[model samples]
Target chain A: LAKTTQPISMDSYEGQEVNITCSHNNIATNDYITWYQQFPSQGPRFIIQGYKTKVTNEVASLFIPADRKSSTLSLPRVSLSDTAVYYCLVVTNNQGGKLIFGQGTELSVKP
Target chain B: DTAVSQTPKYLVTQMGNDKSIKCEQNLGHDTMYWYKQDSKKFLKIMFSYNNKELIINETVPNRFSPKSPDKAHLNLHINSLELGDSAVYFCASSQGTVVTTIYFGEGSWLTVV
Candidate 1:
């Protein structure tokens, strides 16, 4: 399993783009970068998953560099509802769904 | 329709008592899991089952045993619960061993007094 590092918290205002980066230096070849959003008292929701390059979805976008050592999650035009803890995980496909979560970046979206 | 659902969203019990949390997934997924989130907000995997067979068992306590009667159902039973066992337990599921994405259910808040 690959260990990941990310910021502890971030502050952003509404309508501003926010980017949270995660570093996985020992990422394996089969590892995939996955981002999840978690609200208070709720389950974490999957935002996006990427292998390399860039991947975008309706909720967020994930950018992985060519080296695959780090990745970024971009939330466009944030809102107060987007204030939540975002987890970046290095998911191994063959690990029987063991997603080791790191200390997620707590994003507080201001008014 | 809800994909993954767990019962007793909140559980309050005394120490040394046994309790169970039931979970069912309507997504027809083959793999199911149980994760524990401590008060410090660290999420850790406890168990994983595929087609009702045990696959991954972390260093969880022996008192914490997981039962999966079928592919869609996974239940967690804790014996002699302790105060330190208090945390949010999440039930999740995926379609295969190769995890593309795992869906989580609203956690079951367990408080052991």
Candidate 2:
């Protein structure tokens, strides 16, 4: 599994765009980038995933550059409810492979 | 409907006691997993089962035993629990053993005193 690095924390105001970047320099070709959001005292929720280019969903958007070594999770018009810890994971189509989570970026959305 | 659910949302027990946490997924997924989140907020996989077969067993303590009676149910039983065992345990399931996104439950908080 490829190790990932991301910011420890970020601060954003409501109605602002928040971008969290993750670096996976050793990302393999078959690896897919996935982002998950975790609130305090709750399970982590899948936000968006992408192999390459940009993938957008109702909740968030994931941008993967050509090299695939890094990706960015974009949350549009953040709210206080969006304050949570975001994790970036690199995985493949393998069974039983662990989802190695790094110290996720804590985004605090202020009102 | 609850896709994944766990019983005993909060468990408070004395040290050296045995306890069990039950989990069931209504998503009809073939793979179920148990994860432990420590005080530092680090999430680690403890066990994974596919179709009632043990697939991934991390380097967890032998006291932690996971049993899956069927594809939709996975239960975790801890023997001789210690204070360090206090943490949030999450149950998750995926469509298959492959790299599909796993859906998680609300998690069970275990407090060993």
Candidate 3:
């Protein structure tokens, strides 16, 4: 299992872009970095995933550098509703899809 | 149509009681998992099953037992629940064991009084 480290909390205003970064120094070769967002009273939903370089989706974009030791989740033009806990996970294929979630970054998008 | 679903969205039980939360996924996924989110909102993986076989079992208490009767269903049973057991439990499934996208069901909130 790969452990991740992220900020405890962040504050942003509407219309601003928010970028949360996670560090997984001991990431394995077969590990992929995935991000999930969780709102109050709801389950976590996938945001974006990437192995190297960058991957973009309708909701967010993931940026992984050449080192692959860390990844960043970028939310463009944030809104108050974007306030949620964002988790960065490093999952291995041999783990049977088991996700180890750390203390996610609590993103607060203020009006 | 709710690809993944769990029964008893909310459960309230007294300490020392036993309860179970049932989950089923219609996405034809071969792997299922149980994750617990504590009050402070720290999420942790408790158990995982793939093709009706136990694959990952974290250091969760023995009182918390997960049963997979088939590929589509995975149920969690907690015996002698404690106050600390109060948290939201989530059921999730992925297509296979190759680190594909995982879908999550609307969580099951368990409150132990």
**lDDT at position B1, candidate 2:** 93
- Candidate 1 residues B31-98, lDDT tens each? 99999999989999999999999999998999999999999999999999999999999999999888
The residue ranges of model 1 lying beyond 4 angstroms of the native Cα positions read none
- Tens digits of per-residue lDDT for model 3 on B1-113? 89889989999999999999999999999999999989888887888899999888989999999999999999999999999999999999998777746888889999999
B5-101: candidate 2 lDDT, tens digit per residue = 9988999999999999999999989999999999888888999998999999998999999999999999999999999999999999988777748
Clashes of each: 0, 0, 0
State how far residue B4 of model 3 sits from its true place (Å). Answer: 1.6
Instruction: Judging by DockQ against the true structure, name the best candidate.
Output: 1
TM per candidate comes to 0.98, 0.98, 0.94
Query: How high is the CA lDDT of each candidate model?
Result: 0.96, 0.92, 0.91
Question: What TM-score would chain B receive for each of the candidates shown?
Answer: 0.98, 0.98, 0.97
DockQ of each: 0.86, 0.68, 0.69
Measured on C-alpha atoms, candidate 2 has an lDDT of: 0.92
Off by over 4 Å in 2: none
Error of 2 at B73 (Å): 0.5
